[model samples]
Target: MISKEIVVANKTGIHARPASMFVKTATQFKSNITVTKDGKTANGKSLITILSLQLVKGSNITISADGADAAEAVDTLIKMVESKFGEE
Candidate 1:
């Protein structure tokens, strides 16, 4: 398993569009991915679950993946968040 902590950098954080994009990217990996905020965790490949995290700009999140591609999955998602999901 691989995990990384990243701060949400987008203006709107993981809103609908970003959540969709996140789900899309997450689904491409075979790893089991999860997004964690505060004390709650959500399925990374599920839009509803991701949005339920209510992430906002500057919110801290931990992305974790468990599988053969765990490291890649965690890295990719971390980059996405750090890039502000192109919303900036």
Candidate 2:
């Protein structure tokens, strides 16, 4: 498994739109993905699971992936978060 911690950068953090985008991105890879925050972990491919975390601006979370594309999946997710989900 591969993992990296990132801070939510978007103004609204991972709300509806962003959360949808994140879940979509996660499904693009074949790896098993999970996101954890403050001792809570959620399935990255599930909208309800992700939204339940209540990740907001400045919140810290660790994203991890396991599978053949683990590294790529983890890197892509980190980039997405660092890019503020392209919302600027």
Candidate 3:
């Protein structure tokens, strides 16, 4: 398993569109992806699960992945978070 932490930089955090985008990205890999915040864990490939976390701006989240593409999954997720989910 591989894990990396990132801070939400988007103004709206991971709501609606961003959550959809995140879930889409996560589903691209074969690895099992999970995200955690404040002790709450959610499946990265599920919009409902991600949205349930209520990750607001400045919230710290850990992205973890386990499987053949674990490292790539975690790294890509970190990049997505760092990129503010492309919200600018």
Compare candidates 1 and 2 on lDDT and give the better one: 2
Model 3 lDDT tens row, 8-74: 9989889989899889999999999999999999999999999999999999999999999999999
Residue 30 alpha-carbon offset, candidate 2, angstroms: 1.0
Which digits, one per residue and each the tens of the lDDT, describe model 1 over residues 1-88?
8999988887887899989989999999999999999999999999999999999988999999999999999999988888888887
Candidate numbers, best lDDT first, in rank order: 2, 3, 1
- TM-score of every candidate: 0.97, 0.96, 0.97
**Residue 78 in candidate 3, Cα distance off native in Å:** 0.9
RMSD to true structure for each model, in Å: 0.6, 0.7, 0.6
| lDDT of candidate model 3 versus the reference | 0.94
Q: Scored by Cα lDDT, where does model 1 land?
A: 0.93
Q: For candidate 2, which ten residues in a row score worst on lDDT?
A: 79-88
Q: Is candidate 1 or candidate 2 better by TM-score?
A: 1
**Candidate 2 residue 33 C-alpha distance from true site, Å:** 0.1
Candidate 2: which stretches are off by over 4 Å?
none
